[model samples]
Target: MADENAVIVNVLDLPIEWRHNITPYHEVRDPDLVQQLRASMEAHGWQGPPLVCDRDLYEVNQDQAYTGSHRIVAWALAQDDPSADMPCVFIQDIGEHYSIDLGELVEENFGNTYAAVEQFVALLPSDVAEAYGLDNG
Candidate 1:
């Protein structure tokens, strides 16, 4: 389970190896989407903090992202210094039994939105959905 508490951490403080897509095969390469995200971050700043799981809890060497790959990417792209630390929320108390069905959770939380649905449909295949028990059919 993830700890309800969140904390501020620097983007650069995050381990490079752990910066991975939360949803498998959901790498967003769309320049337009990236641009839009960058613009949003530039204008309003990071509204939602990225969710990170503690690697030590999972016996891993580095912390991993549970969500917010796009935001991290946008922060990297929008900043004058990519390594500069920006305020972010890090999820604490993630244990070894923590579920990897993050994609489904994100979709379930935001699936009604067009962008969320588009991204979910674009990246998540039926097989993966089934594996995560997120398949509608």
Candidate 2:
């Protein structure tokens, strides 16, 4: 579970143009892992949303993948749909060394994290949503 201050949002929550604006934090070095991820997603849909950093906090700029960059790439390759409704859990603070409050931004743009997640989940494809047990949300 995330800390109390963080919000779990998704790509669908962002404006249409921003949905595909996210980028990997670094170059993917393991092609084999990406292939595996692609296979898994093709068979099972998304296991879970990727964790992302809300870069620039106050603006709808490019977010960076904190985890699951490989999965993001795999999804893109597998689906050929960069604009697909991909889920993401946004972190406010990485650790004591870094503290950026993205939750406030989420609240400013989309009420609150919980509401945003509910709204996004409802937009997911039934099969995909059901696989994550988020179909009822």
| Tens-digit per-residue lDDT, 1-137, candidate 1 | 12123233333243322232232113555667778878876776655444443233344534444345555566667665454333322332221123334345457777443344334434554544343222321
**In order, what lDDT does every prediction score?**
0.42, 0.52
List clashing residue pairs in candidate 2.
none
**Candidate 2 positional error at 45, Å:** 0.4
1-137 per-residue lDDT for model 2 (tens digits)? 12222233343342211245566655677999999978877777666544444454436666655456676688777677774545554443321113324454457557564454445444446554453334432
Identify the candidate with maximal lDDT. 2
TM-score of candidate 2 on Cα atoms, chains taken together: 0.49
How does each model score on TM-score? 0.40, 0.49
Backbone clashes under 3 angstroms, per model: 0, 0
Model 1 residue 118 CA deviation in Å: 20
